[model samples]
Target chain A: AQSVTQLDSQVPVFEEAPVELRCNYSSSVSVYLFWYVQYPNQGLQLLLKYLSGSTLVKGINGFEAEFNKSQTSFHLRKPSVHISDTAEYFCAVSERDSSASKIIFGSGTRLSIRP
Target chain B: DAGVTQSPTHLIKTRGQQVTLRCSPKSGHDTVSWYQQALGQGPQFIFQYYEEEERQRGNFPDRFSGHQFPNYSSELNVNALLLGDSALYLCASSLGLAGGGEQYFGPGTRLTVT
Candidate 1:
């Protein structure tokens, strides 16, 4: 089984400020990590994913994440944020084992960008 | 591509009533998965359907059922709904055979139980 934990429940930042949303995971087997963003009243949109190869992955909207194997963490970061970046972000994980492809998500972290 | 699409953007029902939500997978995709997102919580997997058969299911009760058609469209049925059942229902689609767990999500259907 795999589970994700987003450490922050809410983060407020000024526009153009850099930010990081922390995520950690626990899995018995190799896992795939993902970040998704949901705007108000909308469904989730894939921000990025780490399946294999590079530990550092870039995603849409100038967002990026690094997979730390030893720490079991996949933290999302953005150098600069915009008002549009204010949304709920979720970290998720799925086992690499074909039998467990279901993605389990964290509770979510709400990012509020201030002008 | 049209991406994944779901119908009945918003619905309202009373307790004990039944509701049906629909979804159409993205073009060229063959698998459909259902998820329930409660208020203030992340989306929880309900089930997944492939080739018109349920290939995976979450911890939901038997009252939560689904059907997939030959065209890859799917329907999620919830029986005897409770106030807690009110939430956003999301549908995701992917190419199961190609592997990789990248699933594209639809806008979602909002169900409000009164």
Candidate 2:
């Protein structure tokens, strides 16, 4: 089974500051990666995904992630974050194909933006 | 069109009782998957239903069951529920196989087992 590890539980940052949420995955088979953001009192919204092709993938809300196969990591980053970006972020991993519809997610990282 | 919507946003039940939660998938999505999210934890896959049949499932026990209708709506039923079942049950809809499409989540049904 594929599993994701998000190193941080909470991140406090000032508005417009750069931030990085680290994620690592463990899987024996080829896998797809995803980042999802859940605002308070709402469901999760996808931030970005890395299926194949380029190692770098850009997503909504000025967020991006780099897929490093050798390191087994897909980390989400933003050059400058806004207070609106404050939310709980999750990193997920799934098998390469339809053989698996399950997506294993990290515990999640709460991003708190300070004024 | 409305996005995915779940019924009974909040529920309270006693241990050993049975409960059912409902979900309507996003328009155009044929696949519905259920997940359990504990407080401060990530959502864990429960099962996936496609074409009115269960196509895939997670590690949950048999007490955790589900059904799908022709309209692609889904229901998750927990029989003889345990206090451990207290969590936010989320319903995520996808166009088809997960690999070929993105999954969208519903607001979720918060179940409180006492």
Candidate 3:
């Protein structure tokens, strides 16, 4: 079984400011990590995923996440954010034994970009 | 690609009534997975269908059932719905890679159970 935890429920930041969204996971087997974004009245879109080979994975919209094996964390970060970044971000984890099926997602963090 | 497609973008149903949602997977994709997302919450997997069979299911009660057709399209049926059943129902499709494949998601069908 796998579980995902996103520490912050809401994060407010001024436009152009750097931000980080934290995520951690617990799984009995090897894991694949992912981040997804949901805009108002829209479905989820894949942000990025960490399968293997690289610890630091870059994704769309100038976002990146670092997978720390020991800390069991996969935190998303962006050097600078825009108002368009205001959306719900989710961190997810699936057992690597499976390709990415049955992934468990975090509760979500609502990122509000204040101008 | 057209990604995944779900029908009846928004629906309203009274409690105790049953509802059926439809989905069409992406081209060349044979697997469909369903999730329920409540307001302010992330999605929770409901089940997955492949090859016209229910391959996987979550902890949902027997009230939730699904079917996949030979054409690869699918439907989710919820019986005896409750107020909590009012949520966004999301459908995802994938290539059915063994283990875990990154499933592509559709915009979702918003169901409001009154």
Candidate 4:
């Protein structure tokens, strides 16, 4: 079984400031990593994914994440944030062997950007 | 280019009651998965349907069941619902096998059990 852990439950940042949301995972086998964002009353939207290849994965809305194998981390980062970036962020993982495997999600980190 | 979609954006039910939620996968999608998202929590996997069959399931009980039609649409049914079952029910869709591609999500059906 695979599991994900998001260290921060909430993070507050001012507009134009940089931010990072930490995520770690545990699995016996190789896995794929992903980051998603959920706006109030809406379903989740994929921010980026790390299937293979480059360690640095970029996504919409000026967000990017670095996959660190030794540290077992996929921390999401943004050089600058906007008020509209305020949303709940989730980190997820799934096994690489099977496409049918269920994706497990972390508790989530609520990002609040202040004007 | 429609994404995944679910019906009854919100629903209210009482404990012990049974409810059904529906979902329509994105165009060209053939797989659908259901998840439960409790307040202040991440969405938990329920089950996945492909080729009109359930290919994988999570730790949820048998009380939670689902079916996929020939058109690739799906329905989720819960029996003897408990207060704890009150949460947002999300339906996601993917092409081919679920693991190989990204899953597009629906707006979700908010189920409130009183």
- lDDT ranking of the models: 4, 2, 1, 3
Off by over 4 Å in 3: none
Worst 10 residues of 2 chain A by lDDT: A94-103
How does chain A of every candidate compare to the true chain A by TM-score?
Answer: 0.97, 0.97, 0.97, 0.98
| Interface DockQ per candidate | 0.59, 0.71, 0.65, 0.71
User: Cα deviation of B25 in candidate 3 (Å)?
Assistant: 0.9
Ranking the candidates on TM-score from highest down gives 4, 2, 1, 3
lDDT tens digits, residues A11-93, model 4? 99999999999999998999999999999999999999999999999999999999999999999999999999999999999
Model 1 Cα lDDT, one tens digit per residue, A1-115: 7788999999999999999999999988888899999999888999999999999999999999999999999999999999999999999987776753578999999999999
Which has the greatest lDDT?
4
TM-score of predicted chain B versus true chain B for each candidate: 0.96, 0.97, 0.96, 0.97
- Top of the candidates by TM-score: 4
* Model 3 chain B lDDT-worst window of ten: B94-103
The Cα error of candidate 2 at residue A40, in Å, is: 0.7
Clashing pairs in 1: none
Candidate 4, position A51, lDDT: 93
DockQ for model 3? 0.65
Residue A72 lDDT, candidate 3, scale 0-100 = 96
Residue B13 miss distance in model 4 (angstroms):
0.6
Give each candidate's fraction of reference contacts reproduced: 0.44, 0.67, 0.63, 0.62
Per-residue CA lDDT of model 4 for B16-90, tens digit only, reads 999999999999989999999999999999999999999999999999999999999999999999999999999
